[model samples]
Target: MGTLYYGDAASPIEIEDRALAHVKVVIATKLRRGESFTLSWAHGEGQEPGRSTVWLHPSIPLRFAFTEAEPALLSRAWIEELATSANSSGGLMIVPEPERGGETGPR
Candidate 1:
């Protein structure tokens, strides 16, 4: 089993996977651009709160360990949801999307 971390709630927010190629791609790109953000996960049955600030960088290797690492990139759907929530709070972070035209783009 892999490690799972929760946000400020008692729900899991992070999961480890050996097959995290796509996720690593997105996260690497963001880190290359020097972006910092926070990722939260719920701990326990929605009773404990957990959170982590991800300091993205190119030097960080993409691997699954027994401890907390930098925050992983969220799925497109999650990103959209976060954007919406940020808007409601009168603030937001703009995360660029991966190129989809089958063209070689910055990694």
Candidate 2:
């Protein structure tokens, strides 16, 4: 599991390491360009069933912590999908990566 620490929130958002890695890339790109957006996601199993949204801004403190010692291989299609969401009016919805065959791109 990975933990995303946003600002000074007492509870860190926990996510799977692979998904969180991809999310980190997309977030960094948007924040670097001074773009602001909301990130929405459905809560994972074992907790209260609900959805959550967080407003992401360039000035806010955000950190991604992974449990793995080495970085996981990223999927290009997934990254593009996330980037598209980041540009949308509804903001970035953290959906699972779409399935594709033999296709990979740079991280």
Candidate 3:
């Protein structure tokens, strides 16, 4: 698991390392372009059964912490999907990573 520290929130958001890597890429790209958006995800196991959303802005302090020393391999297709959501009116909603080395159905 990985931790996403956004702003000065007392509790960091926990996300799987692979998914977090993809999210990091999209977020950095948007922030670099001075764009702000919302990032939302359904709570995983061991947490309350609900969802959470955060406003991401360039001015806010953000950090990604992974248990592994090195970064995970990123998926271009998944990144594109996330980017598409980021550009949507509803903002970015974290979706499961696509299966590797297999044909995926339409989004």
TM-score of 2: 0.92
lDDT of each: 0.39, 0.88, 0.89
Clash pairs, candidate 2, are none
Per-residue accuracy of model 3 over 1-107 as CA lDDT, tens digit each: 99999999988999998889889989999999999999999999999999999999999999999987777777888888999999999899999987764433321
Supply the TM-score for candidate 1: 0.32
Which segments of model 3 are wrong by more than 4 Å? 101-107
lDDT of 1 by residue, 32-106 (tens): 676533333334354456534343334543443334344433355534444453334322323334433333322
The total of clashing pairs for model 3 equals 0
Candidate 1 regions exceeding 4 Å error are 1-26, 44-49, 64-75, 82-107
- In model 3, the worst 10-residue window by lDDT is 98-107
TM-score on alpha carbons, each prediction: 0.32, 0.92, 0.92
Error of 1 at 101 (Å): 21
Q: Write the per-residue lDDT of candidate 2 for residues 1-107, one digit (tens) a residue.
A: 99999999988999999889888999999999999999988899997999999999999999999999788778888888999998999988888878854444435
Candidate 1 vs 3: which has more lDDT: 3
User: Which residue pairs come into collision in candidate 3?
Assistant: none
Q: Best lDDT goes to which candidate?
A: 3
